[model samples]
Target: MKTADPPRPRTRPKRPGAPGAHRRRALPYLLIAPTMLALSAVLGYPLVKLVLLSFQDMTRKELFAGTDPPWVGFKQYRSIFTDAFFWEVVGRTALFTVVCVGLTMGVAMGVALLMRQVDPWVRVTMAGVLVAVWAMPIMVAAAVFRWLTDTDYGVVNWALGLLPGADFTGHNWFANPWHGFTVIVLVVVWGAVPFATITLHAALTQVPAELEEAARVDGARGWQLFRCVTFPVIKPAFVMVTALMAIWDFGVFNQIWLMRGGQPEKEYYLLGVYSFTESFAVNRYSSGAAIAVITVLLLLVGAVVYLRQLLRMGEVE
Candidate 1:
């Protein structure tokens, strides 16, 4: 009673717009400021330059003469948009991305499921092999694949030649565009599968065994058990990996270039290779920049779609 009588003014609550409240709200941004600044410093200038370059009519002449190229707003874009070859490249890139992503995810999921069911030692051995494969440099992997598909002495051709009534000996994998792409897809899927398997295996381990057992007790089996009890838990990880893989596969250049002996034919042109060819090979720098800009825009659209799907999944969960 005496303390109540002596009690003074009540403490005031902070308003949302108060200085302390504002600082508290901004603390997260403050913590991330240095990283944001660093990224801006590294990426901002190049991006600005690229965008500017896309609006200019730059060529080797302008570049070597040390003179600013004349501005030609959207002319490069107009040219490419009207070209049938560009559309073909776009379609090819899209199809390539889909196939590579599909194979990578399928093989990875199968391997991840196998890892979960196998003996611990066997799983460890498999993981070790995957890591070795993952750790191999892209250049080395491309070189190995090139040698394996070599027309004359490739082990792949030799091994297939031994099959009854089958002859793959001296088969030029890169001779036909379809066959060349198949080999490229195999190399891409091979390199891509290990990381995807490891990530998916890690995600699978997070799924509660109790839920799986409960579903099984209710007579859920095989695909039913997975669809009802397992897939939901790992769907987020799966979607993220698939989106990233698609983006990477869309930009694939090195494998095709290397496999085609650094001068990928017109038939092998993906977006990245097409951009490079336009810029350096053809001396059409402005056109290359326009293509690069279009590629970036496409990637942004994909990213937005991925984000929306992820957010929807989060909301559903």
Candidate 2:
């Protein structure tokens, strides 16, 4: 047999670090480097500038003239802490966020449930209407609402006047702080409901009809069925919506600014509006920066709490 074919030799596989292996290993990082660099340029740089501005006595003059700003440390922060108006604004912002988000999500969930119970054609129509409402620009909607709540020729007052023993005709909706606040709340809730409803409806669709049927067979009806079966399945969506709405409503500016910019004793001033007024109106750039920092901190606290709850929920699951 010719000496067993001269004893064939075996070849080993290539090591991971050999030639193209190193490039392949580094490819993923290389791909992500641009995104990280862009984020640093867009977000990180601005954030650093904001922090630096907060610690300095930055004014309109210095900002425009390119002069070196004086460092003031925590003086702006101390002024904000000492000011009762700032605390009031904080409290008002908190209350407005809670109420607006609560009403928006509550009504949205209710509407989504109702949509499921309706005929297919009606459901489609309702969904279309909600989408149309959501598509409207915030400023346009605010302006329309402002006009609708007008004292002399508003449709709202005209409609309310029709109610028995009720008089809303010639009513100035923004005449008082509480009244203006209520109108703002209604406007925000109207704009917010469509998004929440659509998200909730999508989440509801993923839930198995069989699970619902099983729960119903076990005498779980209405809220009981929802609480026991539906909720557990869609909890993630609910928590996500809540967190998103909280953050959004907390920093609402355009709607309130357009409808009524901190009118009636500035009772309607949210953190965003307050910061804008401080910086742009009064030229207190440093103070405004401090307020913006505080607002972010508060939002971070809320986010932390939400994350903790989500983690606990995951553990339970």
lDDT of 2 by residue, 105-191 (tens): 999999998998899999999999999999999888988998889999999999989999999878988778788889899999999
> What are the models' TM-scores?
0.95, 0.88
TM value for model 1: 0.95
C-alpha local distance difference test of each model: 0.94, 0.90
For model 2, give the 10-residue run with minimal summed lDDT: 260-269
TM-score winner? 1
Clashes of 1: 0
List where candidate 2 sits over 4 angstroms from the true fold: 1-34, 261-265
RMSD, model 2, all Cα superposed?
Answer: 3.5
